[model samples]
Target: MLIREATEADWPVIWPFFHDITAAGETFTYPFDLGRDEARGWWLLPPPDRTVVAVDEAGTVLGTAKMNANHHGNGAHVASASYMVDPAHRHRGVGRALCEHTLQWAREQGYRAMQFNAVVETNLPAVALYRSLGFEVLGTLPEGFRHPRHGYVGLHIMHRAL
Candidate 1:
């Protein structure tokens, strides 16, 4: 798979998968029916954010990620990121590669650590990946996310020193 920085034109291809994942309301805390323009503004090109896409040999987007600061001022040295893979492309190492690339990019940009503030506790695969990548479950906020089907689930705060 090829991993590269995303450009403006890539949003059209990225949006459908984004919409599908967010609509599922299984992992992210975003509103289930979040609008396209709002998603574009948040995930595509927001300031202090860098979006990237992973594609196969034929250029089919397998997944996407957005990396940015976890917070402001004193917390800006710690990077934060989000990932989404097309359901059809699951279990092919796309998410792993994207996470690795994001870590590398963050460190290259001088970030001291990487934090994921709200990882749904039900997303075992993602939790496992982060663990394998050396992230620790700093803590979990009880009933932090309201999953559509499994309401009142916990949210994990995961972090890894860069």
Candidate 2:
């Protein structure tokens, strides 16, 4: 798969699954009621930040990831990111590829570290993936998220040095 910068044209392709994933209220911190315009504004970040799409040989967008500084001003040395894999394309290593791409990008950009501020604790596959990629859970905020079915659950703050 080829991972490349996303364009506005890609938003139509991304929004369906994006809606499903966000509306599911299982992983992301985005509000469940996030609408198209607002979601687009949130996901398609501007310069100095990067948003990429992982596409198959046919150019089908399999997943997307957004990478940026974890904080502004004095704390900008650290990077942070978010990912979303098309539901139909899950389990095919798309997420891993997106993640690895982001790591490389962060390292190349001279980030001191990469942190994921709010990984849902019950998202086991993602937590395991992050662990395998060398991210450590710095801490968990007790009852940080209200999972649709699981009630309140912790949100893991995971990190890894570049």
Candidate 3:
């Protein structure tokens, strides 16, 4: 698989997976009905931030990640990132690769730490992957998410120093 910077042309391939993943209510906190324009702006950030995608040998997008500063001004040294893998491509390490790439990019951009602000507690695979990659659970918000199936679930704040 090839991991590369995402282009505007890649949105068509990313939208379906982004829509479905957000709608699933299993991981992300985004509204299931989030509009296209907002999603586009969120994914394709300007300047300092970067977005990337993982594609198979055939160029089918398998996953993606967007990374940027966790906050502004004095807090700018901390970075944050979000990731999504096509459900059909789960268990294939796409998420891992995207994360690895994102981290490297964050370091190159001079970030001192990386954080995930709202990781769903029940998303074990993702949580585990983050853990394996050196992220530690900083805290958890009780009943932070209204999971469609699991009712109320905790949202974790995971962080790693660069």
Best-performing candidate as measured by lDDT: 2
Model 2 TM-score?
0.99
**Mind giving the per-residue lDDT tens digits that candidate 3 earns over 91-142?**
9999999999989999999999999999999999999999999999999999
Per-candidate TM-score against the hidden true structure = 0.96, 0.99, 0.97
Q: Every model's Cα RMSD, please?
A: 1.1, 0.5, 0.8
Q: Sort every candidate by TM-score, greatest first.
A: 2, 3, 1
Which segments of model 3 are wrong by more than 4 Å? none
lDDT of 2 at 147: 98
Which pairs in model 1 have colliding backbones? Answer: none
Candidate 1, residue 162: lDDT? 92
Error of 2 at 124 (Å): 0.4
For each candidate, what is the lDDT?
0.92, 0.97, 0.93
For 1-162, candidate 1 gives per-residue lDDT tens digits of 999888888889998989999998898888888898888888885555799999999999999999998888988999999999999999999999999999998999999999999999999999999999999999999999888878898999999999
What ranking emerges by lDDT with the best candidate at the front? 2, 3, 1
Backbone clashes for every candidate come to: 0, 0, 0
Model number with the top TM-score: 2
